[model samples]
Target: MSQTAGVKPMAIAGRAVSERERCLGMTDAERAWRKQWLKDQVLASNEPVHVEELWRERTNPIRRFYRAPLDKIFSGLSGVLGAERAATYRYITGKLGLLALGILGIHYYFKYNGNDWTKKGGWRVLKSKPLVLPGQEGFPYKSDRKQPSDYAERGFKKAAI
Candidate 1:
Protein backbone atom coordinates (compact mmCIF):
# COMPACT_ATOMS: atom_id res chain seq x y z
CA MET A 1 0.00 0.00 0.00
CA SER A 2 0.99 3.59 -0.76
CA GLN A 3 1.32 6.52 1.73
CA THR A 4 -1.93 8.16 0.37
CA ALA A 5 -3.94 5.00 1.34
CA GLY A 6 -2.51 5.17 4.92
CA VAL A 7 -3.03 8.95 5.53
CA LYS A 8 -5.53 11.52 4.21
CA PRO A 9 -4.76 14.83 2.40
CA MET A 10 -5.95 18.21 3.85
CA ALA A 11 -8.98 19.94 2.18
CA ILE A 12 -9.89 23.66 2.12
CA ALA A 13 -13.31 23.64 3.93
CA GLY A 14 -15.95 22.49 1.34
CA ARG A 15 -13.61 23.24 -1.66
CA ALA A 16 -11.42 20.57 -3.34
CA VAL A 17 -7.83 20.26 -2.04
CA SER A 18 -5.45 22.23 -4.29
CA GLU A 19 -2.44 20.54 -5.94
CA ARG A 20 -0.24 23.34 -4.45
CA GLU A 21 -1.48 22.46 -0.92
CA ARG A 22 -0.70 18.79 -1.59
CA CYS A 23 2.85 19.56 -2.92
CA LEU A 24 3.95 22.34 -0.48
CA GLY A 25 1.64 21.16 2.39
CA MET A 26 -0.14 24.45 3.27
CA THR A 27 -2.13 25.03 6.49
CA ASP A 28 -5.87 25.88 6.75
CA ALA A 29 -5.21 29.67 6.90
CA GLU A 30 -3.08 29.55 3.69
CA ARG A 31 -5.78 27.60 1.86
CA ALA A 32 -8.42 30.12 2.91
CA TRP A 33 -6.26 32.99 1.60
CA ARG A 34 -5.77 31.23 -1.75
CA LYS A 35 -9.55 30.63 -2.12
CA GLN A 36 -10.28 34.35 -1.35
CA TRP A 37 -7.69 35.46 -3.92
CA LEU A 38 -9.32 33.30 -6.66
CA LYS A 39 -12.79 34.69 -5.81
CA ASP A 40 -11.44 38.30 -6.00
CA GLN A 41 -9.93 37.67 -9.45
CA VAL A 42 -13.24 36.22 -10.78
CA LEU A 43 -15.33 39.17 -9.44
CA ALA A 44 -12.86 41.74 -10.83
CA SER A 45 -13.07 40.16 -14.33
CA ASN A 46 -16.93 40.09 -14.21
CA GLU A 47 -17.19 43.92 -13.89
CA PRO A 48 -19.61 45.20 -16.58
CA VAL A 49 -18.72 48.07 -19.00
CA HIS A 50 -21.70 50.56 -19.10
CA VAL A 51 -21.15 53.06 -21.95
CA GLU A 52 -24.35 55.02 -22.78
CA GLU A 53 -23.48 55.76 -26.48
CA LEU A 54 -23.40 52.04 -27.30
CA TRP A 55 -19.97 51.55 -29.10
CA ARG A 56 -19.46 54.96 -30.75
CA GLU A 57 -18.17 56.74 -27.61
CA ARG A 58 -15.59 55.35 -25.16
CA THR A 59 -15.32 58.23 -22.62
CA ASN A 60 -17.34 57.45 -19.48
CA PRO A 61 -17.88 58.82 -15.93
CA ILE A 62 -15.89 56.01 -14.28
CA ARG A 63 -12.64 56.90 -16.21
CA ARG A 64 -12.97 60.68 -15.60
CA PHE A 65 -13.62 60.03 -11.90
CA TYR A 66 -10.12 58.57 -11.51
CA ARG A 67 -8.33 60.76 -14.12
CA ALA A 68 -9.07 64.22 -12.63
CA PRO A 69 -7.02 63.75 -9.45
CA LEU A 70 -4.19 61.98 -11.32
CA ASP A 71 -4.07 64.79 -13.91
CA LYS A 72 -3.86 67.45 -11.20
CA ILE A 73 -1.08 65.60 -9.36
CA PHE A 74 0.89 65.04 -12.60
CA SER A 75 0.68 68.70 -13.63
CA GLY A 76 1.81 69.84 -10.20
CA LEU A 77 4.83 67.46 -10.01
CA SER A 78 6.09 67.75 -13.62
CA GLY A 79 8.94 70.19 -14.55
CA VAL A 80 10.60 70.27 -11.13
CA LEU A 81 13.59 71.84 -12.93
CA GLY A 82 12.56 74.03 -15.84
CA ALA A 83 14.46 74.63 -19.09
CA GLU A 84 15.87 77.98 -17.88
CA ARG A 85 17.46 76.46 -14.76
CA ALA A 86 18.94 73.57 -16.73
CA ALA A 87 20.48 75.95 -19.30
CA THR A 88 21.85 78.21 -16.59
CA TYR A 89 23.67 75.37 -14.81
CA ARG A 90 24.99 74.03 -18.15
CA TYR A 91 26.39 77.45 -19.17
CA ILE A 92 28.11 77.96 -15.79
CA THR A 93 29.77 74.50 -15.89
CA GLY A 94 30.94 74.99 -19.52
CA LYS A 95 32.58 78.34 -18.65
CA LEU A 96 34.33 76.65 -15.72
CA GLY A 97 35.68 73.91 -18.05
CA LEU A 98 37.05 76.53 -20.49
CA LEU A 99 38.63 78.48 -17.64
CA ALA A 100 40.36 75.30 -16.37
CA LEU A 101 41.62 74.50 -19.90
CA GLY A 102 43.03 78.02 -20.27
CA ILE A 103 44.85 77.69 -16.91
CA LEU A 104 46.34 74.34 -18.00
CA GLY A 105 47.52 75.92 -21.27
CA ILE A 106 49.27 78.68 -19.32
CA HIS A 107 50.92 76.09 -17.02
CA TYR A 108 52.34 74.10 -20.00
CA TYR A 109 53.55 77.27 -21.71
CA PHE A 110 55.46 78.36 -18.62
CA LYS A 111 56.88 74.83 -18.14
CA TYR A 112 58.35 74.78 -21.69
CA ASN A 113 59.59 78.42 -21.93
CA GLY A 114 60.76 78.76 -18.31
CA ASN A 115 64.44 77.99 -18.99
CA ASP A 116 65.10 81.06 -21.24
CA TRP A 117 66.10 83.21 -18.25
CA THR A 118 68.65 85.54 -19.88
CA LYS A 119 67.83 89.23 -19.24
CA LYS A 120 68.23 91.34 -22.44
CA GLY A 121 70.64 93.94 -21.00
CA GLY A 122 70.67 97.55 -22.09
CA TRP A 123 69.69 101.00 -20.69
CA ARG A 124 66.03 99.83 -20.35
CA VAL A 125 65.11 102.37 -17.64
CA LEU A 126 62.22 104.77 -18.40
CA LYS A 127 63.67 108.24 -19.09
CA SER A 128 61.57 110.51 -16.84
CA LYS A 129 61.92 113.76 -14.95
CA PRO A 130 63.96 113.55 -11.76
CA LEU A 131 62.17 113.66 -8.40
CA VAL A 132 62.22 117.25 -7.10
CA LEU A 133 63.38 117.68 -3.52
CA PRO A 134 64.29 120.48 -1.09
CA GLY A 135 67.93 120.35 -2.21
CA GLN A 136 69.75 119.37 -5.39
CA GLU A 137 69.83 115.70 -4.32
CA GLY A 138 67.38 113.52 -6.27
CA PHE A 139 65.64 110.37 -4.85
CA PRO A 140 65.92 107.56 -7.38
CA TYR A 141 62.80 105.28 -7.74
CA LYS A 142 63.60 101.55 -7.39
CA SER A 143 61.56 98.51 -8.24
CA ASP A 144 60.58 96.16 -5.37
CA ARG A 145 63.00 93.45 -6.61
CA LYS A 146 66.10 95.74 -6.71
CA GLN A 147 67.76 97.27 -3.63
CA PRO A 148 70.69 99.72 -3.69
CA SER A 149 71.95 98.19 -0.39
CA ASP A 150 72.51 94.90 -2.21
CA TYR A 151 74.73 96.62 -4.81
CA ALA A 152 76.57 98.47 -2.02
CA GLU A 153 77.41 95.16 -0.36
CA ARG A 154 79.00 94.09 -3.66
CA GLY A 155 81.53 97.01 -3.47
CA PHE A 156 79.60 99.24 -5.92
CA LYS A 157 78.93 102.72 -4.51
CA LYS A 158 77.66 105.98 -6.07
CA ALA A 159 79.54 109.13 -5.01
CA ALA A 160 77.78 112.49 -4.65
CA ILE A 161 79.34 114.80 -7.21
Candidate 2:
Protein backbone atom coordinates (compact mmCIF):
# COMPACT_ATOMS: atom_id res chain seq x y z
CA MET A 1 0.00 0.00 0.00
CA SER A 2 1.17 3.57 -0.71
CA GLN A 3 2.14 5.98 2.15
CA THR A 4 -0.97 8.06 1.46
CA ALA A 5 -3.16 4.96 1.90
CA GLY A 6 -2.52 4.79 5.65
CA VAL A 7 -3.33 8.52 6.17
CA LYS A 8 -7.11 9.14 6.17
CA PRO A 9 -8.11 12.36 4.37
CA MET A 10 -9.76 14.97 6.58
CA ALA A 11 -12.53 17.45 5.69
CA ILE A 12 -12.51 21.10 6.68
CA ALA A 13 -15.09 23.71 5.55
CA GLY A 14 -16.81 20.93 3.53
CA ARG A 15 -13.77 20.16 1.36
CA ALA A 16 -11.62 17.00 1.42
CA VAL A 17 -7.95 17.66 2.37
CA SER A 18 -4.88 15.62 1.42
CA GLU A 19 -3.31 13.26 4.00
CA ARG A 20 -0.25 15.51 4.38
CA GLU A 21 -2.45 18.60 4.88
CA ARG A 22 -4.49 16.74 7.51
CA CYS A 23 -1.45 15.50 9.46
CA LEU A 24 -0.31 17.58 12.47
CA GLY A 25 -2.60 20.46 11.36
CA MET A 26 -0.04 21.45 8.66
CA THR A 27 0.21 20.85 4.95
CA ASP A 28 2.06 17.56 4.43
CA ALA A 29 4.53 19.43 2.16
CA GLU A 30 5.44 21.87 5.01
CA ARG A 31 5.87 18.99 7.50
CA ALA A 32 8.21 17.21 5.10
CA TRP A 33 10.19 20.46 4.61
CA ARG A 34 10.42 20.94 8.42
CA LYS A 35 11.61 17.32 8.88
CA GLN A 36 14.24 17.85 6.17
CA TRP A 37 15.39 21.12 7.81
CA LEU A 38 15.89 19.37 11.18
CA LYS A 39 17.95 16.61 9.51
CA ASP A 40 20.10 19.27 7.85
CA GLN A 41 20.76 21.15 11.11
CA VAL A 42 21.62 18.01 13.13
CA LEU A 43 23.73 16.34 10.41
CA ALA A 44 25.52 19.48 9.22
CA SER A 45 26.79 20.82 12.54
CA ASN A 46 28.38 19.11 15.54
CA GLU A 47 28.11 22.33 17.61
CA PRO A 48 25.35 22.41 20.19
CA VAL A 49 22.65 25.08 19.93
CA HIS A 50 23.02 28.20 22.08
CA VAL A 51 19.37 29.29 22.39
CA GLU A 52 20.27 31.95 25.01
CA GLU A 53 22.53 33.71 22.49
CA LEU A 54 19.54 34.02 20.18
CA TRP A 55 17.49 35.41 23.06
CA ARG A 56 20.22 37.93 23.95
CA GLU A 57 20.36 39.08 20.32
CA ARG A 58 16.63 39.88 20.50
CA THR A 59 16.90 41.67 23.91
CA ASN A 60 17.42 45.40 24.50
CA PRO A 61 21.02 46.61 24.53
CA ILE A 62 20.67 47.98 28.09
CA ARG A 63 19.46 44.60 29.38
CA ARG A 64 22.30 42.86 27.50
CA PHE A 65 24.76 45.21 29.19
CA TYR A 66 23.37 44.34 32.63
CA ARG A 67 23.75 40.61 31.98
CA ALA A 68 26.88 39.26 33.68
CA PRO A 69 29.61 37.95 31.34
CA LEU A 70 29.12 34.46 32.78
CA ASP A 71 30.61 32.71 29.73
CA LYS A 72 34.02 34.33 30.27
CA ILE A 73 33.80 33.74 34.02
CA PHE A 74 32.87 30.08 33.47
CA SER A 75 35.60 29.59 30.88
CA GLY A 76 38.19 30.78 33.40
CA LEU A 77 36.63 28.47 35.98
CA SER A 78 36.85 25.54 33.56
CA GLY A 79 40.59 26.15 33.18
CA VAL A 80 41.13 26.11 36.95
CA LEU A 81 38.39 23.74 38.16
CA GLY A 82 38.13 21.31 35.22
CA ALA A 83 35.19 21.00 32.82
CA GLU A 84 32.83 18.82 34.92
CA ARG A 85 33.20 20.80 38.17
CA ALA A 86 33.00 24.07 36.25
CA ALA A 87 29.76 22.96 34.61
CA THR A 88 28.26 22.04 38.01
CA TYR A 89 29.40 25.33 39.58
CA ARG A 90 28.17 27.29 36.61
CA TYR A 91 24.70 25.75 36.93
CA ILE A 92 24.58 26.48 40.68
CA THR A 93 25.96 30.01 40.44
CA GLY A 94 23.77 30.88 37.47
CA LYS A 95 20.59 29.97 39.39
CA LEU A 96 21.76 31.85 42.50
CA GLY A 97 22.73 34.93 40.47
CA LEU A 98 19.35 35.02 38.76
CA LEU A 99 17.62 34.72 42.15
CA ALA A 100 19.65 37.61 43.60
CA LEU A 101 18.96 39.76 40.55
CA GLY A 102 15.25 39.05 40.88
CA ILE A 103 15.23 40.02 44.56
CA LEU A 104 17.17 43.25 43.97
CA GLY A 105 15.00 44.12 41.00
CA ILE A 106 11.88 43.72 43.17
CA HIS A 107 13.44 45.72 46.00
CA TYR A 108 14.43 48.63 43.76
CA TYR A 109 11.10 48.48 41.96
CA PHE A 110 9.33 49.09 45.30
CA LYS A 111 11.92 51.60 46.55
CA TYR A 112 11.65 53.90 43.51
CA ASN A 113 8.11 53.26 42.33
CA GLY A 114 5.57 55.17 44.46
CA ASN A 115 7.92 55.02 47.50
CA ASP A 116 10.66 57.56 46.98
CA TRP A 117 12.84 58.04 50.07
CA THR A 118 12.82 61.87 50.11
CA LYS A 119 9.44 62.44 48.49
CA LYS A 120 7.55 60.35 51.05
CA GLY A 121 9.11 62.02 54.13
CA GLY A 122 12.13 59.71 54.39
CA TRP A 123 12.05 56.51 56.48
CA ARG A 124 9.09 57.36 58.75
CA VAL A 125 6.50 57.66 55.94
CA LEU A 126 4.33 54.79 57.04
CA LYS A 127 1.07 55.54 58.92
CA SER A 128 1.84 53.22 61.83
CA LYS A 129 3.83 54.53 64.80
CA PRO A 130 6.65 52.55 66.36
CA LEU A 131 5.88 50.59 69.53
CA VAL A 132 6.81 52.31 72.82
CA LEU A 133 7.62 50.42 76.01
CA PRO A 134 5.52 51.04 79.14
CA GLY A 135 8.19 53.25 80.72
CA GLN A 136 10.10 54.49 77.66
CA GLU A 137 9.49 57.87 76.00
CA GLY A 138 7.66 58.30 72.63
CA PHE A 139 10.09 60.55 70.62
CA PRO A 140 11.71 64.00 70.39
CA TYR A 141 14.03 63.11 73.23
CA LYS A 142 16.17 66.08 74.31
CA SER A 143 18.68 66.58 77.14
CA ASP A 144 16.88 69.62 78.58
CA ARG A 145 13.22 69.17 77.57
CA LYS A 146 11.51 65.81 78.32
CA GLN A 147 7.96 65.20 77.07
CA PRO A 148 7.16 61.54 77.34
CA SER A 149 3.87 60.09 75.96
CA ASP A 150 3.43 56.85 77.93
CA TYR A 151 4.14 55.78 81.53
CA ALA A 152 7.48 57.64 81.27
CA GLU A 153 5.44 60.89 81.24
CA ARG A 154 5.00 60.74 85.04
CA GLY A 155 8.77 60.51 85.59
CA PHE A 156 9.44 63.39 83.18
CA LYS A 157 6.74 65.52 84.86
CA LYS A 158 8.35 64.94 88.25
CA ALA A 159 11.82 65.69 86.85
CA ALA A 160 10.57 68.95 85.29
CA ILE A 161 9.13 70.10 88.65
Candidate 3:
Protein backbone atom coordinates (compact mmCIF):
# COMPACT_ATOMS: atom_id res chain seq x y z
CA MET A 1 0.00 0.00 0.00
CA SER A 2 1.59 3.23 -1.21
CA GLN A 3 1.12 6.69 0.52
CA THR A 4 -0.53 8.22 -2.62
CA ALA A 5 -3.08 5.38 -2.80
CA GLY A 6 -4.51 6.21 0.68
CA VAL A 7 -4.48 10.07 0.63
CA LYS A 8 -4.87 12.98 -1.83
CA PRO A 9 -1.39 13.87 -3.26
CA MET A 10 -1.53 17.56 -2.00
CA ALA A 11 -0.43 18.67 -5.51
CA ILE A 12 -2.10 20.33 -8.45
CA ALA A 13 -2.40 18.87 -12.06
CA GLY A 14 1.35 18.06 -12.36
CA ARG A 15 3.36 20.71 -10.41
CA ALA A 16 3.29 20.82 -6.58
CA VAL A 17 2.19 24.30 -5.41
CA SER A 18 3.15 25.24 -1.78
CA GLU A 19 0.20 27.69 -1.56
CA ARG A 20 -2.18 24.89 -2.40
CA GLU A 21 -0.78 22.79 0.48
CA ARG A 22 -1.21 25.71 2.93
CA CYS A 23 -4.81 26.40 1.72
CA LEU A 24 -5.74 22.75 2.01
CA GLY A 25 -4.48 22.69 5.64
CA MET A 26 -6.76 25.58 6.71
CA THR A 27 -10.61 25.86 6.71
CA ASP A 28 -12.29 28.70 4.70
CA ALA A 29 -12.92 30.78 7.88
CA GLU A 30 -9.24 30.51 8.97
CA ARG A 31 -8.08 31.37 5.43
CA ALA A 32 -10.21 34.57 5.44
CA TRP A 33 -8.86 35.58 8.91
CA ARG A 34 -5.26 34.98 7.81
CA LYS A 35 -5.80 36.99 4.61
CA GLN A 36 -7.36 39.86 6.62
CA TRP A 37 -4.40 39.81 9.05
CA LEU A 38 -1.80 39.87 6.25
CA LYS A 39 -3.54 42.92 4.71
CA ASP A 40 -3.83 44.70 8.12
CA GLN A 41 -1.97 47.58 9.85
CA VAL A 42 1.50 45.97 10.15
CA LEU A 43 1.77 45.59 6.33
CA ALA A 44 0.17 49.04 5.73
CA SER A 45 2.64 50.71 8.13
CA ASN A 46 5.57 50.17 5.73
CA GLU A 47 3.92 51.59 2.57
CA PRO A 48 6.06 52.75 -0.43
CA VAL A 49 8.70 50.61 1.28
CA HIS A 50 12.05 51.76 -0.05
CA VAL A 51 13.06 55.45 0.45
CA GLU A 52 16.79 55.82 -0.31
CA GLU A 53 16.55 59.61 -0.83
CA LEU A 54 15.09 60.15 2.66
CA TRP A 55 18.18 58.56 4.24
CA ARG A 56 20.56 60.28 1.79
CA GLU A 57 19.31 63.81 2.64
CA ARG A 58 19.42 63.24 6.42
CA THR A 59 22.96 61.71 6.55
CA ASN A 60 24.59 64.63 8.45
CA PRO A 61 28.33 64.80 9.23
CA ILE A 62 27.99 67.72 11.66
CA ARG A 63 25.38 65.92 13.80
CA ARG A 64 27.56 62.77 13.76
CA PHE A 65 30.63 64.85 14.81
CA TYR A 66 28.67 66.15 17.82
CA ARG A 67 27.40 62.68 18.80
CA ALA A 68 30.09 60.11 17.84
CA PRO A 69 32.89 60.75 20.39
CA LEU A 70 30.52 61.19 23.38
CA ASP A 71 28.35 58.23 22.31
CA LYS A 72 31.15 55.71 23.00
CA ILE A 73 32.09 57.47 26.28
CA PHE A 74 28.55 57.09 27.73
CA SER A 75 27.98 53.67 26.11
CA GLY A 76 30.84 52.30 28.22
CA LEU A 77 29.58 54.26 31.26
CA SER A 78 26.32 52.25 31.23
CA GLY A 79 28.37 49.07 31.85
CA VAL A 80 30.44 50.84 34.56
CA LEU A 81 27.19 51.94 36.23
CA GLY A 82 26.09 48.24 36.37
CA ALA A 83 22.93 48.92 34.37
CA GLU A 84 22.94 45.30 33.12
CA ARG A 85 22.14 43.86 36.54
CA ALA A 86 19.52 44.64 39.21
CA ALA A 87 21.19 46.11 42.30
CA THR A 88 20.03 48.81 44.73
CA TYR A 89 23.62 49.97 45.44
CA ARG A 90 24.34 50.61 41.74
CA TYR A 91 21.11 52.56 41.22
CA ILE A 92 21.70 54.72 44.31
CA THR A 93 25.30 55.59 43.33
CA GLY A 94 24.38 56.32 39.73
CA LYS A 95 21.57 58.70 40.71
CA LEU A 96 23.77 60.43 43.34
CA GLY A 97 26.42 61.18 40.70
CA LEU A 98 23.71 62.56 38.37
CA LEU A 99 22.27 64.70 41.21
CA ALA A 100 25.71 66.15 42.03
CA LEU A 101 26.34 67.21 38.42
CA GLY A 102 22.89 68.81 38.15
CA ILE A 103 23.45 70.79 41.36
CA LEU A 104 26.94 71.94 40.24
CA GLY A 105 25.59 73.20 36.89
CA ILE A 106 22.72 75.05 38.62
CA HIS A 107 25.15 76.73 41.04
CA TYR A 108 27.40 77.96 38.21
CA TYR A 109 24.43 79.23 36.15
CA PHE A 110 23.12 81.29 39.10
CA LYS A 111 26.46 82.54 40.53
CA TYR A 112 28.69 83.39 37.54
CA ASN A 113 26.12 83.68 34.73
CA GLY A 114 23.49 86.37 35.44
CA ASN A 115 23.02 90.22 35.71
CA ASP A 116 26.09 92.28 36.70
CA TRP A 117 28.73 90.45 34.65
CA THR A 118 28.15 90.81 30.86
CA LYS A 119 24.72 92.52 30.58
CA LYS A 120 21.64 90.86 28.83
CA GLY A 121 23.27 90.39 25.40
CA GLY A 122 24.57 86.97 26.57
CA TRP A 123 28.06 85.48 27.29
CA ARG A 124 30.78 87.53 25.64
CA VAL A 125 34.13 85.94 24.72
CA LEU A 126 36.38 86.17 27.77
CA LYS A 127 39.17 88.55 26.76
CA SER A 128 42.45 86.83 27.70
CA LYS A 129 45.40 88.82 29.08
CA PRO A 130 48.70 88.65 27.15
CA LEU A 131 51.15 86.07 28.58
CA VAL A 132 54.67 87.28 29.37
CA LEU A 133 57.71 85.04 28.86
CA PRO A 134 59.42 84.28 32.21
CA GLY A 135 63.17 84.68 31.29
CA GLN A 136 62.95 86.61 28.01
CA GLU A 137 61.78 90.04 29.19
CA GLY A 138 62.62 92.07 26.04
CA PHE A 139 62.45 89.26 23.45
CA PRO A 140 59.26 90.72 21.82
CA TYR A 141 55.70 89.20 21.93
CA LYS A 142 56.01 85.80 20.15
CA SER A 143 53.38 83.06 20.46
CA ASP A 144 55.70 80.38 19.00
CA ARG A 145 57.99 80.10 22.06
CA LYS A 146 59.01 76.56 23.12
CA GLN A 147 57.24 75.08 26.19
CA PRO A 148 59.09 74.73 29.55
CA SER A 149 61.28 71.61 30.34
CA ASP A 150 59.11 69.38 32.65
CA TYR A 151 56.19 69.59 30.17
CA ALA A 152 58.54 68.37 27.39
CA GLU A 153 59.25 64.95 29.01
CA ARG A 154 58.55 62.42 26.19
CA GLY A 155 60.33 59.53 27.96
CA PHE A 156 58.38 56.26 28.19
CA LYS A 157 58.81 54.18 31.39
CA LYS A 158 58.46 50.41 31.23
CA ALA A 159 56.18 48.81 33.86
CA ALA A 160 57.99 47.44 36.97
CA ILE A 161 56.66 43.90 37.24
Off by over 4 Å in 3: 1-60, 74-105, 113-161
lDDT of each: 0.54, 0.61, 0.56
Candidate 3 has its poorest 10 consecutive residues by lDDT at 150-159
> Can you rank all candidates by lDDT, best first?
2, 3, 1
**Reference-based lDDT, residue 113, model 3:** 66
Shift of residue 35 alpha carbon in model 2, Å: 43
Note each model's CA RMSD in angstroms: 26.3, 13.5, 23.2
Query: Which candidate number has the best lDDT?
Result: 2
Per-residue lDDT over 73-137 for candidate 3, one digit per residue giving the tens place of the 0 to 100 score: 55567677663442444456567877999999978886676443225643433334477676768
Q: What does candidate 3 score on TM?
A: 0.23
* Deviation from native of the Cα of residue 88 in model 3, angstroms: 17
Where is model 2 poorest over a 10-residue stretch in terms of lDDT?
A: 11-20
What is the clash count for each candidate, in the order shown? 0, 1, 0
TM-score (C-alpha, index-matched) for candidate 2? 0.32
